[model samples]
Target: MHDVVVAGAGPVGLFVACELALSGCSVLVLERDRDPRPPLKALPLGLRGLNAGSAETFYRRGLLEATMQASGAEAQEVGADPEAVEAPGPRALSHFAGMTLNAADVDTAALPYRLPSPAMEGFMTSLDAVTSVLTERASALGVEIVRDAPVTAVSQDDEGTVITAGGRQYRSRWLVGCDGGRSAVRRLAGFAFEGTEPLFTGYVAEVVLADPDQLPIGFHLTDSGMYLRTPFPGHLGLMDFDGGTFDRSQPLTREHLQAVLRRVSGVDVTLDEVRLASSFTDRAMQATTYRMGRVLLAGDAAHIHSPLGGQGLNLGVGDAMNLGWKLAATVRATAPDGLLDTYTTERHPVGAAVLDWSRAQVATMNPGPNAPALRKLVHDLMRTTDGTTQVYRQTSGLFAHYDLGDGSTLVGRSAPDFRFEDGTRLGDLLHNGRGVALDFTEGRALDGTAQRWAGRIAYAAGPVRNNLGFTALLIRPDGVVAWDAAHTPDRHAFERAAHQWFGAPSRLTTGAPSL
Candidate 1:
């Protein structure tokens, strides 16, 4: 029997399996698709944006460099030579409901908590590149992935969970469904998925245009719906608010696409060839709970919303990172009581926030009478420092914080990539997939406490370029700050936090003190 059985080999499943395997758990990943490469996973159609939090998570696992390289980015220049200077260029802008906001307009000074780092705030990459990088990493970590194995049924009891796929039964201590939005595992497991219905059916396609010049580059809002023509000669995207009436199950033909484009763009553009076509909807839904008995859900299997701001991939990856370590600990029987429960409690809110964000964008994009005015207001607001800061923070995933009963400002937030005096950054310490007790003061109190959980929690004492008002911090394996102190050290609170996160010190380790 496998320690964990993960259904679907998408980025989320691969990431979770990698995490489990990294901690010495036997992971078996079952993928429904036989082939890994698909046109939709390539560039132009499969483009996705990785926010700061997602990028940081990749960096923690030492996969960020590989992902950036696979995306054809100048990976060496990203953090290799900080002193290298380059020519100035136009600021990158992020869009909301097709409205763009220049990064330069946002005041970085307002976000004093954010530490300077070589990692980017965000970047664009394709699904293929992400999956490739994660697959390689998962393989390197000793994870077994089987293709053409789709889970047809799921059954769980107190002993374990049984999964039937491709006429074979597999047993595992735990199961996770990382399948797409139309998740069969979720249905078979009887999860309650609830959310708002779609307001429109969106189309994304690559085509050969006979009269490409007829359509201008960039986005267009029309009375019928919205449309976008990319710089790529024949690439087009369209939104039809017909209450999702278009038959998505049917293949999109040249004639059908031309008609939809004409109706949405109000242009008689001719499509000579339809290279590839796919459909999506604003139908947002999320499981009331992420887990049901021995089975759990992650990525699109747990929640799904419109790809308005490209938050779906990032949100899904975040879910995997948040759940991976907790689940691994639970499987190993080393986790404290209620550790696995926090996965749903913490991630459910983030998923809900993203859904709401997508809904807000849909509201602004509606062709209703008030939508134009509201869009105008948002556009004008984005031009201001405060507005740009708020939008940047939200879209970049920097604004996400768990309610861990705030004491220090850093508590319950992602730990900053603080550059230490010895040329090491906080992200460097998380490569081993363990919690960290960072002591900026090099004080003996926290150091001695961390010694008890030495193998479980790495203790790093050093001075940083900027501590951000934090003297010490306890960061979870997911890079979230579990606890922090401003100035004075609290041994009792530090010990309690160590127990809460890493569990009591290993009894087998000699010289381990009682918490």
Candidate 2:
């Protein structure tokens, strides 16, 4: 029996399995898909939050960065490897399309960030690269990933959870459903997913343009649709689509791709090499709950939305990172059972927010009668510096702020990255553990308190960059500051919060001290 059995091997499931295994929990992942494939929805890694910069702190778990680097290297070898003779595809053209990334728009200092050449264009890679790397990592971490296991049923008892597929039953103290939106585990758990269904269908095709120069880095020819031409190691990334009705009964055809490009771009283009194409509908749905008994849900199984901003994969990957630690701590007997509840509280709103934002993005592209006027107004607004900045920030997932409940100063606000007296930045400190409490000002010296909750919390003295007047601050695992007290905090107040947040302040006394 595994400590936790994860259903599905998409980015989320794999990520969660990686985290759990890293945290020293035994994990088993079951995936139905053969592997990642070309024309797969997930595009190149953003590397936006690699350093946990001003973004929502989603991609800071460090696994994606490693995966991205390895993938890029493999792709580079595919294109530059002396043994290979095949030329890269058209997607490679957008490499020098001169893409622009405005740091100021992200509420950060104006600094230039170059999109990697391998990521922009070079070699062609499929989703297999991502899964393969993750699978290898999981295996190294002692995770057992079983493929072709299409789970059909899930049963939970007071003792644990049982999952059955192909007449094989696996039992575990906990069950994690990393499955996709149409999750069988969700159905078996009787969880209700509440949200809107997709009304529009999008057709996507992978092609090698005969003349890649025709494609720009990124351009929206029609307000209702866009023609994004990005470059990969050896090929160009060309995606053009607008909302349309869906007829899944009919296979997507090359003629349909030509018609859409012609109608939207007003250009008749022939496909140099039509590698892969498919039609997909967008839906905005989130589970009513994240857990049932010993069973838990993460990633697409918990929430799903339109891929307007390429947030589907990012969000799923973030979900895994968020849940992995909390669940590991609980199973390891370090965290209180109530700690698991915070996962839903913190992530549910995030999922809902994604749906809301992605819905608006899709709405802007709705090709209705009002589309022309709406498009004009949007264009006029976006032309402004302020509007352009706002749109850029919002669409890039840099402005998502979680409401950690109204309590004290900076409870919910994302903690501003600050420098410590020792010259350490908050982002630098987060690499160690969940959150830290830094008391630059003279607060109640957590003398015995330091020994109390050692592993879970840390206290250090430093000069905060913001000068927000908060002497003491409580940070969350995701690097968001939950509570800040400019003045010395009351010992009782801090203890009460510690009890509530981590559960059982008394445990701190008996547990091992944190680093």
Best by lDDT: 1
Q: Give one digit per residue, the lDDT tens place, for model 1 in 88-178.
A: 2113546788887777887766665666555645677889999999999998999999999988999999988999997899999999999
- TM-scores for candidates 1 onward, in order: 0.95, 0.78
> Compared with the true structure, what per-residue lDDT tens digits does model 2 show for residues 295-325?
9999889988765655666577557767887
* Candidate 1 similarity to native, TM-score: 0.95
Report the lDDT of model 1 for residue 467. Answer: 79
Off by over 4 Å in 1: 75-93, 507-515
Off-target runs (Cα >4 Å) in candidate 2 are: 36-68, 71-137, 210-217, 223-225, 232-248, 333-337, 383-389, 392-399, 421-425, 442-444, 462-468, 506-515
Which stretch of 10 consecutive residues in model 2 shows the poorest summed lDDT? 89-98
